[model samples]
Target: MSNPLGGLARRASFIDSVRQEGCGVCIVDAGDFIAREGRISDKNSIQLRIAAEFMLQAMDRLGYAAANVGEGDLVFGDSFLAGIAEGLDVQLVSASVFAGGARPFAPARMFTTAGITIGIAGIAWEGFTPYVAEHSDPGRPMAMAATADAMREGLEEIAGADVKVLLAHAPLSELRILLADIPGYDIAIAGHDTNMEPFAEPELAGATRLVNRGWDGTHAGRLDLTFDRTGALIAVAGSAVLLDAAWPDHPDMLTLHADYLARVAAALRDILAEYPVSPPPTGTRYAGVQSCVTCHPVQWGSWRQTTHALAWQTLVERSRDYDPECFACHTNGFQWTGGFTLYEDTPAMAAVQCESCHGAGADHCDAPLLPYSRPGEAACLRCHVPLHSPEFDYGTYLPKVAHPKAP
Candidate 1:
C-alpha cells in the first residue's frame, strides 16, 4: 500500500497477482485496527465476528496468508476478537496475547511452502494490551517485559526451526528497539506507526532489514531477495513495494469482502450517512439562527453581522490543518489541511450565518428542539477557557460574542 488514495482497489489487484504467481506472500498488520473512525461496535458474538472478519478479509483479499493482530483490536475486547481469530483461516501470532488451558490462540505461527519454513510472531507495545477474559477462560494482557521475555522464546523457536523471516506488530518506537536487541531474525515488519512511510531503516544487529507498511493497507512493503537451495540467504531483499500502484486483489478475499461489506454498509448507512439538509446558502449546514433566536438573539444577530460568516474560507485545501481548536470558534465552517471554502454559501456569498453559533440547522429547523440547539456553557468553554479548568467567564465571552448595547 503506497498512497491512501485509491488504496482499496489498488491493493486488491496487487495481491491477486501475487496469489496467482504462487509467490509466498506475507501480509503484516501493525496495529490499531479497531480504534478507527468507521469501526463497528456490537455486543453480539456474530456482529463482533463480522467486524473482525471484514478487516481480515481485506488482507486475505490481498495475498497475505496470515497476520499478527494489534492494539486497536483490543477495542472490541479480547474474547470477541479471539473468537474472530478462531473463525478465520489465517493464523493469529502475538507474544503479547496469553490464553492458557488449551487456548485456541498461538503466540507465533510458522508458514511453510515448498519445504521452507517462515515463522511470523507478534508483540504489541506495552500500552496496547486490553482488559478481558474471553471464551470462558482466564486471560491477561501480556506485560511489556513479559512480552519481551516471550519474544525471546519466539525468536528461539525461529532460530531452532531456521525460519528465514520475522513479521511483527507493535509500535514503531518499540519495533526499532527490538530490531536492535533481537538479531536472530533476518527481516522485521513494523506496524502501529500511523505516520510511517513504509521505508526500510538502517541495518541493525549487523544483519536485519526493517520496514513499515503505512496504515490501513494503503502502502505495502515489497522486497525481492534470494536464497540458496538450502534456503540460506544468497542476496539481500531489496525493492520497496507500496500498494498504492497497480496490484492484484485476490479473488477469494474480494468475494469475502463483497459478501460481508454489503451487510456492514447496509447496517451502518443509517448511522453514518449525513442526509441532504435543505443545504444552507453556502452548502454547509449550520443549525440556523432560528433555533436559538428566542434564547440568544443578541449573540445570533452579532454573528450575522460579522466576517465569521465565511468560516469555510479558512478550510480551503488544508487537510493537515490538525484539530479545530481556535479557528473554529473565531471563524466559520472548519479548517482542514486542504484549505477551507464555504461550499454551502458559495465562495462569493459564504458567511458564517446565524447558525454558526447555534449548530447545524437541519435537525432543529423543523422543530425548535432546545436540546440540540444549545450545548450550554461547556461547549463554548473549549476555546474560551484554559485547559483543565472548570471555570469559564461566560460574561466576558458574551461581550465579545454580542454587539455592545447603545452607549
Candidate 2:
C-alpha cells in the first residue's frame, strides 16, 4: 500500500527532462491498474480512480494524453472500474470491451509530446474470455483469432482519423500474430506478456513494429513514428529503459506516492479490524506457493517451473474452462505431504513440487531457480511437448535434458 518514499526523486528527474524537451507527448499504461496482487486476496481493487487521478495530474503537468485498461482492470469487477474512470481526461481505450453500446472507454485526445503522436489503445488477453462473458454481454469478444481481425478493422477505421498510433493489452503470442501484418498496424504496444526485450522487439512480421513493456512499471517504452500528412510510415524512434537507481526522480510522483500511503494506512487499519488475523488457524486456503519454497529449497528450487508451479496460474487465468480432469489436478491451494486424499479439496500449491516428481526435496533446492531438477522424461510429460505419462521413462531421458537429448 505504501509507495516508495524515493518516488519523488524518481519523478523529479524524469519531469525535468520532459519540461525542457516540450513537444507532442502521449502516455499509455498496460492495464492492471488494479488487482489482487499475487493471487492472495478475493478483491483488492485499490482506488484505481485514485491512481488515475495521480497519473493524470502527472500527465497534465508533463503534457500528454490517453491510457487504456489491462485485464487487471477487472480486478474490482466492471462496475467499479467504470465508476473510477469518471473525471479522468485520459482515454480508456479498449475496442473489444464496451459499456452497453458506447465504446469500452477512450478519449478524443491523441497525446503529442516531443513531436510524437502516440495512438494509444487497450486490449486484454483473449484468455480472459470466460470472465468478460459473465460480466458484460458486450457481444464483443477478444478471441485471439478474432482480435487479429479487430486490429485490422480498427486500423482502417482509426487510421483515417489522422491518428497513427495503436496500443493493445493482448498476450505476447497474440501480439506476435498482429505484428505479422504491417502498414495496418504502425506501432503496437502490448501488456499481458512480460518481455525483457529492448524497445519494440519487433519482427518485420510482415510490416508492423511490435513491443511489450513487461510489467510493474519497472521500465517504460516509447515508439515515435514520423508519418507524412497522408499517414505513411516515414520513420520511427523507440526506446525501452529501466526505471532503476539511475533514472531521475519526479517530485510530483513522489508527492503522489505519499498521499497514497496515507490513505492505505487508514484503509488497512479498518480491514485488519474487520478481518482480524487468528493465531495459526487451520483449514485456510492460500496461494501458498511463495511460502513453501523459503524453507524447502532443494526440492522447491527444481520445481519452480514444474507443472504444479505452473498449474495454479493456469487455473487462475482459465478456471471457467470445462476440463474436469484438469480442474482436479489444479488447485486454489494445496498441502504437499498430505497428498490429494480429497480430489475436491484444496491442494497444497508448493509451486510444482519438483520434489514430488524428482522424489525428494533433500537437495538442489538451495541453489538457483534455473532448470532446478535435471530434466527427465517425467518432467517433460508433465509439461512441454507433453505425452502420455505411461510413455515416459527415466532410464531413457536424463535430467538437464536440454535440446531433447533424445526423441
C-alpha RMSD in Å of predicted model 1 compared with the true structure: 11.6
Q: Residues 1-407, candidate 1, lDDT per residue (tens digit)?
A: 22223345566676556667866655555555545323434323343455566776565545455566565565555566676566566766666655443333566777775466777766665554333232223453333325466567668756645454555566667766766776677777776675555665424533667766556544545655567887875655544555543565445555665666556444433322222224443323543444445765676576656545434444343221222222345343333211123333223223445445444554455554524443456656645433222244777555545553412
Best by lDDT: 1
Off by over 4 Å in 2: 1-12, 36-40, 43-64, 99-102, 107-118, 133-145, 161-163, 181-183, 195-198, 226-232, 273-407
Each candidate's lDDT (Cα)? 0.52, 0.49
- 1-407 in candidate 2: lDDT tens per residue? 11111233454565466546754445666665454223324323343444544554555454445555665565444555666556656556665554444454542234554454545544555566565555453454322225655465456546544445566777677677666744665667666654344355454445666667666454556565567876556876777654556765565666665675456444543332333233211222232434445655554465554445675566445332222223324542122233322223435531334333443322233333423334345444544321113234455543433222211
Best by TM-score: 1
- The TM-score measured for candidate 1 stands at 0.59
TM per prediction: 0.59, 0.57
